[model samples]
Target chain A: MSPDLLLCLLAGLLVGCGVHLLLARSVVRALLGFLLLGNGINLLFVVAAGPRGRPPIVGLGEESQPMADPLPQAMSLTAIVITLAMTGFVLALAHRSWQLSRSDVVEDDPEDARIGLRAIENDMSESDFHGGVDADPRHVDPDEAPPGTVPEEDDGSDPDPDAAPVGSAPGEGAEPGVPGSDDAEAGLDADRPDHVDPDPSTPEPPARRPGQEGAL
Target chain B: MSGEMLHTVLTALVPLPVLLPLVGAGIALVVRTRTRLQRAVSVTTMSLVLVIAITLLWGADTQGRLLVTVGGWLPPQGITLVVDRLAALMVLVAVTVTFAVLLYAIGQGRGAMDRESGGNAPVPIFHPTLLVLLSGVSTTFISGDLFHLYVGFEMLLAASFVLLTLGATIDRVRAGISYVFVSLASSSVFLMALAMIYAATGTVNMAQLSVRLAELEPATALVLQVLLLTGFAVKAAVFPMSGWLPDAYPTAPAPVTAVFAGLLTKVGVYAILRTQTLLFPASPLPDLLLWASLLTMLVGILGAVAQDDIKRLLSFTLVSHIGYMLFGVALASPAGLSASIYYVAHHITIQTTLFLVAGLIERRGGSTSMSRLGGMAAMSPGLAVLFLVPALNLGGIPPFSGFLGKVGLLQAGAEQPTPLVVALLVGSVLTSLLTLYAISRVWSRVFWRPPSVAPMTEDNRLERRYERRFALAPGVVAPTAALVLVGVALTVAAGPLLAVTDRAAAELLRPDGYVALVFGGGEVP
Candidate 1:
């Protein structure tokens, strides 16, 4: 095969294989794919520089064939350096993931799942926006005081959704002072990040919240 | 300096804004152990950059387009750095915001040290990395060639990957992975496009391409245009391409998020604006831009409203608001371009201010979740005011620069008045209203409600809830308030700023003067 044809075939195979790996779930494979793609691009850039000729250096009046362009060589070097830097960072990240989770697979994101569910749940017709409350039976009380109103010093058995220190009525799921500014604006607070205390019934150290898994 | 010498020096000073921060970063890296000296170097470097940026703006406005060829090679043979009105204005805003964020980060760093890790807690490498990021952004702004712009993107992306993973929390590491993959993918596309442009036209010197590209067949030109635009589209986070942004931006520390939110996407817009005007003057896909602007605005705002997190909400709005800039770019008129330019500046200040305010909220309330935070208005009135001002500005309330930019764009859209343009106009108005709705929602939820009232679902979580007035230090509050003042100043000075934007747009639309300056008054042979 001609030099250009061979180069083209090699570049195509690298790119095809790279894209396949890039789509895989495993971090190590994805990283390999990224490297393959970079090499493929470098090859594409070299081939695009057109038919190779004599080394581009010129001496005084020396007879020479057409000199090959050197810009792609420079670009390929730069691209290789960038790829090397990125590869180091990715390897660090992969190593970190393995250390933390004992696997090199990317974790499934709950946030992404929630967002996809939100798109389907939100057609924008409902007056309220939050897709209803969590399926857990314990959180269904409308009469309970809203979260965050009770000072940290106080246990939240009184459940003040409207801790009306000012003019708020004491009970019966207090009315909002500002009409437009209500819990309703945010739609339903369903799936709101709940504060699951050590259950009074079980009395254990508080269970780590799912999202607060990371140490601050 | 003598007048002649001054002109020469000023001609040379065009590259200093890009150089100063790099030098500062290098020096800071060396003295990284000496916290005070590190701060001094970074601060002095950015201050000098700010001064240089102002001088460059004055010089560009008066001196026509100033061009520098690295190592004195002519035209397409060397890397060209040009300081036009647009480049100078962008540099000024970028440095100013970076400086403000630096102040906030330093103060925050000190305060975090005092609070948690006492006595000379290892001064973070934040300053050097931030300066490096600033240098990359400066390079992106002033670069006169497509290849230099790619280098700028890489430098910044590498810096950001480090910044985003500052703490290496599992969440941040996750965000970093997504950020890296998305950025690298776009960068590869950008490189492919650059290679193709070189292959097709034999040049990536944008000014030279301006002359060469016009001669290509329409179909061939269209393919090249699409490729280049796709690369910029990813950077600009236009609509479907913007998914990585909301994911990536919110995971970083507040100041990091603020700087990234402010500078990165706008630089992408700047790239799109510059390349579209220069290389492909009569773009083949204004209709595509129109549809894109429409969808990006609608979808981004909808996504913003659906979220409960403050940083994520602002991130969504940032993506949504880029549509307004694209709207102007799509119209392809002087009025449209000017409006886009003005909006870009306005959005940078507004977005940065809002994100910084989000930082303050997180610091004060211990959470950015609207469901968790409340009573900020009464407890920390200062923080409330800080959030309110930029939030209102972002929502496009009257007398704000946001409102002015929207009106300028709407009027420009009216001038040509195509069906698609009209659709975009309606979308713009709707987006603004929805932005207001979204901002007001945050205000009522986080600021209006007493800290006592929390989300219905969060039961018996008093220990985690912040109980008292947040006693903030003078340092964090001052820089944040300073950025807020910057946003207000934009509104106050809209008249003169709009004039400058108009001049920049005029220069952009008519780039023969620029091309000549870059190419030494010669046509591309």
Candidate 2:
């Protein structure tokens, strides 16, 4: 059966507008988007029920005139209730967000943001960094390499000798000269050089560094 | 009892799993002010449901599928709840996990309440909401109609939104917004898919659709399949759609995160499994599933490897292992499907146990960050053991059920021996190895290394005070240890469990039994 073109077009319009709003960063907009999206789908349900007919009452409609399918209407009613409940819930969440952070925008996950920043600094893919793929062989110490196998470009002529030493010492500290040291320092104990010395007898501190937790 | 009476009795038991928790949820909500009574009511309700699920499992195993028409209305016109082997097994495992997590949440809640001395009495909403979530999950498992399944998803999603933001802490609020939006988006997609399906087939009943969907043109069927899979994949946290999971899950209280991590996504996987097997048996998208599985595995594990927080790490692994189940489903063979089913059950228990263990780690170590946590093994050897067993199980160590499930999937892949299957087999092993690496990294950093000296700061001081207030409770530890034992139990029972899953897979791959039973007047054949 051919679907109702006008209803279909209306549903399409609502869905298109709904998705556009859903992509916005603001929670209120997303909630509105959800409402519109839900209503669009509900309309689709109506359209799917086929050609319109008299109210699906048992005795009100004549036998010659077919009644609308009641099933989709029932289903759409359920959908409306659920959508209303969720809209209320999301509204509450948006209010909570405003109360907590004084903003209604969805915040980027701190860890994700940090990782993205590191990826840019390192000029590498985020997955490569996460996968522990070291792009530059120079980050590997020349001393650790076999005697004859050092790259031809590596003549130990680099201006920064300390860079070599930092790269050579395992777990001493992240290389400050490296572009992604911000990530390394935040991730490892590189920022707190005192942590480099493993003092077994030191009492456990009551507090960790503020803001270092990064969304834990 | 005579055969007829037995059938009647078993049919009567089918609805209890969904009904009991809902009724309990109502009672718990009424008694919300009395924390003790709420706990008791919730626990009792779940226990009773657990018993009913076990009986249903036995009945379904012995007597073909058990069907129940809601309100005594016949199918294609009424809501149907069918407990074939697949649904029964899923319900049983789901109830078991929810029950244990509830115990852990209760223990944790009690500890928090005691320390605060009623100043921060546990939010009474947790009990009722959790019960509602359990009911929603059970409804999804037993639902015989597509729209009913959609309702089940909404019930659970609404309940979860409440549970996730229980305390409405800033971090949780932030997390909950993203979670709610993503869930709503997926639910809309699912609703749209249902609308389309109804438009095509003129019915929402699965049994009727099973017969009717087969007659539709191939292209139409593929569109429906893709739409359905898209919705379920987001819920399941399959790749490209999985980014929200790690971000959203880690910020909640441990028990909330534990249940969400364990059961919520599995519900999505269960829907995918149900639809794939019963509605679209001749899936045109196995290749798509295979590619998705491979990407999910690789991408999810890589994310896990980079994570410093144990909760986020476990969340990523949860997404990664979903690939293994998808792999089994993609194979579309009995061995493959059976192995996938076994893996789902195995992964649910293992993943939940690990999250519970992470909670324990947080309680004892004062943080779940691998950087901040250390020497937990030395400080709390019992907690260490609890963490180690599940960690090993999750990493697919030999003799664990994880290994067994992977072996089954691999062997199934071997049977197909197609290039894509071969690629998946290799990818599966790689994912497993990478998983082990990620897990071991967490183990060494969080458990073995010397405790780091955290810098003294006001935030840290407040956190320490909070930690001291809710000092580790034996009540909490016991439930976690119990769940860890449950994971081991999966290992010990792997043999018989595989047998059940094998039969379940056979039934899933062959949908005629289901269609027949659902339409055949709820009768035992």
The TM-scores that each candidate's chain B achieves against the reference are 0.95, 0.96
lDDT for position B462 in model 1: 33
Candidates' lDDT values, in order? 0.76, 0.79
User: For each prediction, how big is the interface RMSD?
Assistant: 13.3, 17.8
User: What is the Cα-based lDDT of residue B33 in candidate 2?
Assistant: 69
The CAPRI classification for model 1 reads as: incorrect
Candidate 2's TM-score on the B chain: 0.96
* Tens-digit lDDT string for candidate 2 (B397-433): 9999999999999999999888998999999999999
Note each model's CA RMSD in angstroms. Answer: 8.6, 11.9
**What does candidate 2's lDDT look like per residue over A132-208, in tens digits?**
31222233322122111222222122332112221122211222232222232232333233334323332232222
Q: How do the residues B1-525 of candidate 1 rate in per-residue lDDT, one tens digit apiece?
A: 676776798888988987888888899988876666777898899889999999988888877778889878666857899989999999999998999999887756533321111111223567888998999999999999888889999999888888887755456667777787778888887887887677777777888888888888888888888888898899899988998899889878789899999999998899989988888887647999999899999999998988778999999999999999999998888999999999999899889989988987876665687755666676567778899999889899988889999999999999998888888889999999999999998997788855543334344333232222223546667788899999889989988888888999999998677787776676565
